[model samples]
Target: MKRILVPTDFSAHAENALKVAAQVAKKNNSEIILLHMLELPHQMNDAITSGASIPETMLFMKKANETLDEISNRNYLDGIEITEIVKMDKPIHGITQVSKEYEIDLIVMGSHGASGIEELLIGSNTEKVVRNSEIPVLVIKKENPDFSASEIVFASDLSEEAYLPFEKLLKFAKLFDSKLHLVTICTPNSFKPTHEIEKITKSFISKFDFSNLETHIYNDTNIENGIINFSNSINADVISMCTHGRTGFAHFFNGSISEGLVNHAIKPVLTFKV
Candidate 1:
């Protein structure tokens, strides 16, 4: 059965993501894993080292469990085997470790975007997991539930890794019954295709049951601009891509295309790691 992992922090945004995950899981007959990570307050750890009251820590843990149960019960997630995991540690580390251990197929998390100094530090936990995960990650913005993905735009380099996650995307498209648009942006300095591009495109199409698929190629100066323009032109509901999760100097100098898309795109962006 398909396993979907959703990490919650008892936030409304996380709850929104769980709602969407429930819809997807219900449609696919998949199982859902609800995860909660409890990172103690910074001062609490210092207090513990200084021989503070251990009962306080116990109270905090109890509260965390109560919060998880409250959210789970509120959602009334039924017809699926819902598993809950609560961990006390760093949120990102806890999530990444659990994802690998469970072999999660998809991860649904919530984000409120980035702000000020936190933008440079790590942006958000959803962003970090999207970059670090080897599975598909869907970050939902908590607001309204009126969003419907009518057209799915995929930004790819047509590399060997590009096709790896298409199976999951196909499953997503089928669930939504949305049209799948495959797009590739070619740079001015990039090598032109030696063989027929249609041959490669046809080979990829043969792998999926895509009765609603369209292909397009654009000659653009920059990858980010090309994707944004195509998405705007098509009025895409969601933009999907694969990211390599380069950090440090690389992330600073050469910002991630997926990150750029998320920051700029008017539509929701879903990222899958290969």
Candidate 2:
């Protein structure tokens, strides 16, 4: 991982994420792209593209740049190369565009869940980013004063197609020397006998060369609930998952469970599309 794109609205939650990003950058010597986006007033939205003549857009951009300057110069960000970006665009679009344009290797953002959106709108947009971004996303839900990825829980169906994302997960886990806990959620509706579940789990992993790993089969009422409960039980530092874009988790038929977890998981969530 090289450039980490952190989209900020200058909220407390966003600052929480920046603190975490500083930690990550120090460890990896990566560049931080701190982006601030403005969804201008309806009348000024089109005018923003014309030039810097519009007063509203200009004012917001100046304020955003000043705020970015303040954030970039903080003691916590000292010695770290930061590229502050200010643009007139929606948060999600700006993030995606910058991620691609800069060839961002990872995206880190903070959230206070969907419930806290009134005071932290940018924080809550983590759901939209997790639902859409192709690049790996690491979400910070709250202030993790002493963040470390010692234990990571990766919930998946262990399908053959899952190997690709798992490979990506492995690279991330190795960053912090995190031990991977690979879990397969066994739900009541899709219940299987213990031996059958083990047989499948073992078969899927047998073909791969994985080290510093443990396998598990957790039972619960549903996939999302199962994942959350299992992760909490282990006190995992991070919850990793794969989603099929808008269709939600590849294992789920419903179209919202992936974001549901992203919006609700108390621990940080690391997600990417399959």
Candidate 3:
């Protein structure tokens, strides 16, 4: 982890994720890029008289900078390399642009009250980034003053697309020296026998050299709940999965299990794009 990009709305939850990112930075000696965006209404530029929007824009920009400075100066982030960026573009675009500009290794974001909010990922800025970013995104839900990837519950369908992200997951797990709780969720709609699952799992992991690994077959009605239930059963620190970054009609029909998990699961979710 060389640099972490954290997009903030200055909400309590954003701070929650920021604190966790601090712990991560401390662990890896990584730099923290705190990004705040001020998107002036597009209509203002066209409808308002010339220079009419300048005052409000500058005022908001100044206030955002002050706030960013305050956060960077917080004692919790002490001794950490911090960079503050305030962009004028939309939230998702700003995040994408900044991540590339800074060569960020990871993005840590605070979940915006995922409880009972079934509204699809397409509508939310955070979810939009989750759906598009090529790098790993860590969604933090609550305060974890001492966050650690001591154990990660990684659920997979063991499909071919999973291999790529699993490799990224392995690199991360090894970096943190975390135990891997690899699970295959078997639902009624897509059930498979334990012997077959074991056989596939054996073959799937044959290409890797991770020693701190555990494999299991879990049963539940859905993938999201099964992963959550299994994670709860072991009290794992993180829930890991792969997202296909589905969008438009495909996302509408198939819906992303990883995105759904981010919405409902209280535990931190680590997602990588397949």
Candidate 4:
């Protein structure tokens, strides 16, 4: 973890993400890039002719920079190297662009936890980045989440596509020296015999040659609910999963399980693109 990118709206949840990122930075001797995005206001030609949008946009930019400075000067950042960036673009675009520009190792972001139709339509900016970024993303939902992950719950179908992301997930899990709890969510629509589930789980585990892990099948009405219930049951430190990176209106049809988890799960979720 040489460099971490944290995008902030300066909300309490964003502050929570910053704190968690600080912990990781402290542990790995990493640098923190504190980024803030200033969305350009939309208006008609009349507003542009009157120069009304200019001052408003400038004020917004000024305020954003001030907030970034305030966050970077906090006492907790004493030993951490912090670089503040203020971008004039949408949150997701700014974040992904900066991540590439700086060669960021990971992106830690805050989510407002959108759900159902609202979740699909008005997906949070954090959710958008999780869907598009090539690097790994850590979605933080609460204030002061435990940074030291002792146990991680990874829910998946153990499909061939999942194997790639699972491999990246293992590298992240090893950073905290955490035990992995692998789970297959058995929903009514996709239920499998226990023996079949067990066989696949065992094969996946053996193929990976992973240690310090356990596997099981969890029953629920859906994958989202199944993951939430099982992680809560195990008191998992974090939830690791793979995103198909579905975008646009197409996401409405393909429906990413990773996005669903990000919207509903209260625990920190680490996502890798499949």
The candidate that achieves the highest lDDT relative to the unseen native structure? 3
lDDT of 1 by residue, 68-106 (tens): 776667544767678888887787898889888888888
- Candidate 4 regions with alpha-carbon error over 4 angstroms: 44-59, 114-123, 247-255, 258-260
How far does residue 143 in candidate 2 sit from its true spot (Å)?
Answer: 0.6
Measured against the true structure, the TM-scores of the candidates, in listed sequence, are 0.78, 0.90, 0.92, 0.87
Report the error of model 4 at residue 237, Å: 1.0
Best first by TM-score, ranked: 3, 2, 4, 1
In order, what lDDT does every prediction score?
A: 0.70, 0.80, 0.82, 0.78
TM-score, candidate 2, is 0.90
- Please provide the root mean square deviation of candidate 1 (C-alpha atoms, Å): 4.2
What global local distance difference test value does model 4 have? 0.78
Residue 42 lDDT, candidate 4, scale 0-100: 62
Ranking by lDDT: 3, 2, 4, 1
Model 2 regions more than 4 Å off? 46-53, 114-125, 252-255, 258-260
How do the residues 51-80 of candidate 3 rate in per-residue lDDT, one tens digit apiece? 667777778889999999999999999999
Instruction: Give the Cα RMSD of candidate 4.
Output: 3.5
Clashes of 3: 0
Q: Which has the better lDDT: candidate 1, or candidate 2?
A: 2
Q: Over 4 Å off in model 3, which ranges?
A: 47-50, 116-123, 248-255, 258-260
